[model samples]
Target: MVKKWLCAVLVSWWCLCLWAAGAEHAGEKPLNWHENAFFGLHFDLHPNAGDTELGRETTAEHIREMLEKVKPDFVQYDCKGHPGYTGYPTKVGAPSPGIINDALKIWREVTREMGIPLSIHYSGVWDSRVLEEHPEWARMDPHGNRHPNYVSLLSPYPTERMIPQLLEVVREYDIDGMWIDGDCWAALPDWSPACQAEFTRRTGIAEIPKKAGDPHWEEWLAFHRTLFKEYVARYVAAVKAEKPSCLVTSNWSFTVRMPEAMDVPLDYISGDYDPSFGAERAMVEGRFIASRRVPWDLMTWSFLKTGDQPWTFKNAAHLSQEVSTVMAQGGAVFIYDTPQRSGRLNSWHMDVLAEVARFCRERQPWCHRTETVPQIAVLHSESTWYTRNDPLFNFGGANQPMEGALFALLESGWSVDLLNETALAERAGQYPVIVIPEVTRLPEAFRQAMAEYVEGGGRLLISGGEAAEMFGELAGITFA
Candidate 1:
């Protein structure tokens, strides 16, 4: 009887030690700003031909008025947009036409005084100036002609001109950070002499494929992926070297377009949710970003503009609904707004933001840093998306399958997490079930991890024909 009692006491003591250690570890984890409910504003201002001195002054006044009405944690103002035009006087890039004063400087001064963090919206990898000045820096097409739209990261423009200009904003203006736009949207496979030589050097293939399905097409795709990854990493490193506290993120860096970009040392992850499909996209992307365990936010358009139509402010009720959906999935909220050419913000927009801010602020207690109780996890393979048509592996194109799975699970009222392979390998055991939806190919390491997860009594639900054919035996079934 004494021996059994002593053993019980030892077991209880051991469990208590583990529990104490876990509590200490949890306490040591630092809190991120994104872990809380953050309300921010994104303003994209591109002056047109008619913008005059009166417009600039009025706009500046309205900016102060708007801030007073709707206080935000952060505001992202335009520095340089897609047209490679700066709203401020810039030595490194072209200034927008008809800009009489430095709008960025005014915004910096105002936001700083207001005690709000300021970020700039700068377009990267797609500068129209390079198209005109150095067309060779543009991405090359199969016809050996430069694309009129995008600049290649392989060019010296990003390192020499772009990074320098970005650092200039941080140093000269004392800005908080940069929300880099047009990175994923502008990245394209290049067939330039440099790319061709590098491909040959890496793969030992002298001839490069001209189009999809040609010889070595897969190798070409893989090469571009690696190129962009390295390109982003280098730029991020450069920015940190200059200003370690300067938050830098390429738009859509960690979303469906370039999940591998998470490997880059970015301060945070964010994407502008499509206005048309804002709710659905936010639900999926929020889970994806949250799984990375980094700070993330989703930007939604304040107005719903369709196909060259004039912009109109979204109703407060609609905006509130959209914000709630994102916050519920553990994402902060940023609303995108385009100011009038006169530089004045609409009072209606301010009222709308005020209402939405109130909604978010009220829910801070329950919503901020609240852990998501995940019931299901859907595996999203970045490799499958990147190498979709290689003929070497079976995988579907784009994120349609993953989206379909999310929709179905949500419709059935199940809480789901959209996990990348890395997240799944690490935390697959936490959830009750793992779902592989339409992912035809998975890396060997991920495959082994999934097998072990299932063998250890975890449940799995796999859909899609190709996935069934591959993982059928592991799930205790055969296709015959």
Candidate 2:
């Protein structure tokens, strides 16, 4: 009787799969690439540096030399703020005098010649000029103090002003991609007039929470995420409209809760840094590599104390794990060096990267694909992750407090990606089991989808925060 029941269940599942696939419309977008990839070495443009300045042709040439030497599959060009910007020979925004001669073309020509795709990095969070030029665009903290290096998503400038300049640069230069840094949309302050107005409009409540977990919080929090998602959609659209093949993603480290919304418009997604620093960081990084629908890139050296300043972590295990994780994910690994800040590339760092490069080359077939038979799908939602923004409810870490827990799983042999809820809705059936480590504030749409999947037989594990309440609310069921 049990065998008969099992067979019947299998048949039902097979039928559902067929139906879902057939349900797609002719104009519906196709599935995206799930592969391991590369992000280029990141060296910030310094005005006064050793034979290199921001926007200088020499810098691009030097970068090209490094790429030729490293033979990386992709590379990123840093566009420093103010006079140091490296985007292109732009008329909208003034690029550094360093490239006023012909450096921009050299950098562009070198990457194209090398056949390695180029990604440009920009600090979108804090622009001194933006603040100075447009005080209205600045986000004000509770104390009424404006923080440096932070941009208010509530400001319309990104879509109106910033994107056009970015497009002009891309179109003029024919660049292949973008990496947006300092995207603290989730952490944008509460005093923005735009946010206040939106909050009032959405929940009929004018008061914003002073902290993360205040009573009327989830609604406001949801708005913040919604705004960010829309911003991402717009940014991605601008790039793809100009160059459909161009890849683009913002830094999403701890901001995403459910699976990423792949349908939202992104060629790929990435994070600021990876924190796996021990022997086990490698496998966990590998798991992160495979967890995303698109290729993942690991940030290296950004978080470290530079050797030039002061070195931390004797072994360089952190750097090694960066490459390992990206390789494991069948994604790309990016190494960032901020002049004298991210320390000089020591022999140890170079050696680890070299080994990783060689390993990726050797395992090209397996390392270039997203994981199949994923043992776990970590439920990620921007709404839930913001719950940690509470000073009191402090879950853990700046990026993914659940990393330690996820690491435990990886150490015990598990792979995972911190995906947004939208991503979860579409791909829920792919995984047999999913673990929502402390997710709260579930989106109704994602909840309904998850409920159906689980009822049809999906195993779920959740911990910390309001995962229980959310599950109960969403599915009309609860799990401990």
Candidate 3:
């Protein structure tokens, strides 16, 4: 039977996010991320150290032209990226070489004048600059070698650099907020002396595990994960305390990729799905965020992964398909684009953006803030994924069985919501059918809950060897 339910439509078309470089709104009241900020444009270059002539050609006319044509809800411009270089010159942060013009000023002026919320894409945890300069702050790998890209949480990088730069941009540009990238996904397990010392104090585990198979391996991973969570909470709190109105979100913090409950003080939740399987990735990410209690959106890469192309811009129809996938899943959508080295958008790029804008606006009235009517609850087990995978968040890692299961149900045309142990515990009987897909292990509490739910006549569907063995008797399935 194809699981189905009524789709409750809440129609409030959001503004276009025409972010040529920086940018929001149609209604009399200004739209923000909390409510009406729907369609968006994300333009980034991931600022590098060797970059020169940054924003030299990003004139007022070019930004205004693109904004007028697309008229997005909010515009997110590149501020700081993985390289730890700032696009705009700042008194506090490491500025890129040869930044001639005040591009951030121009973007803020135009966006503010046009009454649109202009946010920034700032790289948080991963900083090559920080790693090179402060070798002591680097996250040490199990082999005693400091990471070449990531920073250690036990170090003062967050306090000394990350938070200061955030506050600096907030106060300097008077910008809307920041979409923090390279954060949760960029976190590496810190095995540095400082981290190990602190981990020992907290957990009383004197012997630190050097590898995943060593003694107290789970404890070591859990300890690092806890520290990363603290790092996020601290920075978010600091930013909000400094600018209470500014929105803050780390890309993919509490999404399906993390398989954890929403605990951070994130103003919104988001993640940029890898373009390799762009459509399929959105199918999982979009639905998971839509099920979240906070405001959320998914960013789509504007181009496909062509080996030679730096960023090969996809045609309007191709991008529109990705946008439609996100819109149909009941969350706002943003299309990611890379501008020229001079920070100017070429006409070729504009042509595709304008066409994509038309497509997104056309569907705005119907799919804006669409809510999922949950019919099938696909359990995304935190224990299962964490035990199998190494990182805290696995966006581009192995395709957990949950992905295949969700994809199968979706292809079969069932309305599904991906839920984890925390979510299911609160509402075990909510979904009409609960499907446990091939998990190596499940919490005993969940097993008891599922058994009780089945005893009370709720449908339970178990698949895969491990999952089937766990609930084989409950499912009344016998294997020879």
Candidate 4:
């Protein structure tokens, strides 16, 4: 009897070890330059109004069908401000009445079954209907207009209310990550009571700056950046406390300095989705930023063809070009879909996605493995855009100079392209030398890529106003 029991125990232990090994083999690491991509739907799932079957469960099943069909690596199921409207049945707090669909639960099941990580898209300073119910939680301007539906980081109450709910959903649904939005809506130094008090404490200044360009505006902006960094740090701590491995990221302003702020504890950072309006140089700078971290997540919009806007269909090719370039640089590419009012995929948009997915799959392995080799790389600085936006600068219409600069590179006899850090991993070796012009920020991934490039007998030329500030010491160059 003893010998039989010993043999059974040995068999059980062996099986357990085999199972653990299998799980590890199946699990994929966070994205790097060569293997990063995400198929995301920002407003993918909405609750059914009537006679409709587009609730969370149905949507999850639908998504699962597509995932099964496509078998892509990543998917971002965003909720925007409608978190409470459609998701697992919440007894504690509900966003709106008569809503019944657990979007998180459905995504959790589907992604987990398919071995994919699910990311929740949360708004940083915007709530759809929470402001109406809780007036104290609302963000107020100098005139006390209540700002309707917008909320700012100035108030800690919203974080107190919303972060817990977010944590609850993640714990219950076993989610893998979060994407924070609304961080760039307003400039920092808001006059909210909490913000004012904190500003006074930090700067020892009793009075608030009134105009947009006060002498203290730079200080005020720094305060806002500090405030967000602290809040993000706290939020990241909270997320890790529960899941221990969940990713936390913010949709940073188009240009953000990633390496300088490494102490700010975010798993990763992403830029906005509208590449059409943004500079391709910014896109290339973004690639440099993504190369700083393990999994570089970059957001790009899909074909947003509505009834009136038919030209958007052609833009799909542009999106494909940009997204494919980013993926090749080793960043996980997220393709966004702006849903129709009916909450179903538009037929034309669907066709575009089908082609995009098909093309990506054909070269999927290459995208995940290639590195960037470029002749010129441009820098993207939010401060430059902010300055350009100021009417006093005489830079013409806001965002015009920056817009013009983006197009001029390609037309000015350069093989212009935008590459993210992840993209750099797969193709960085291809270029013997590169140029970074007009950018003011350096992300860690780009920093590492440059270091490796230069160490391997590559020459880099960094020019422009902000470029000197970001890479002065690193590149051994001085712009006089």
Q: What digit string (tens of lDDT, one per residue) describes model 1 on residues 1-480? A: 434533554464345435534654565422222333288999887533344541365445667778767767778988877777777777886766667667788888777655566889988877886577788888888789998768876788877778888888888897767899878766778988888988899899998999887998878888887787788788777876665556778888877666553678777888998786688778878888878778788898988877888866788888888878878876788899887654567788888898898898888667754568978999888777766633212224467888788888889999988888887889988999999988767888988898899889899888888887777779778766
- What TM-score, to 2 decimals, does candidate 1 have? 0.88
Single out the weakest 10-residue window by summed lDDT for candidate 3.
1-10
RMSD of 1: 10.7
Model 3 has an lDDT value of: 0.80
For model 1, state the Cα shift of residue 130 in Å: 2.5
- Sorted by lDDT (best first), the order is 3, 1, 2, 4
Better of 1 and 4 by TM-score: 1
Ranking by TM-score: 3, 1, 2, 4
Look at candidate 2 and tell me the lDDT of residue 460.
Answer: 74
For model 3, state the Cα shift of residue 271 in Å. 0.8
lDDT of 2 by residue, 165-212 (tens): 779768777766777765543345456777788778878996677665
The 10 consecutive residues of candidate 2 with the worst lDDT sum are 47-56
Candidate 1 has which clashing residue pairs, if any? 59-343
Which parts of model 1 have CA positions greater than 4 angstroms off? 1-37, 47-55, 58-61, 307-310, 389-397
Q: What is the lDDT of residue 292 in candidate 3?
A: 72
What residue runs in model 2 are displaced by over 4 Å at the alpha carbon?
1-39, 46-64, 81-90, 94-102, 185-187, 212-215, 253-263, 274-289, 306-318, 338-356, 372-384, 390-401, 413-480
After best superposition, candidate 1 residue 307: deviation in angstroms? 5.8
lDDT of 3 by residue, 393-413 (tens): 664444468888898998999
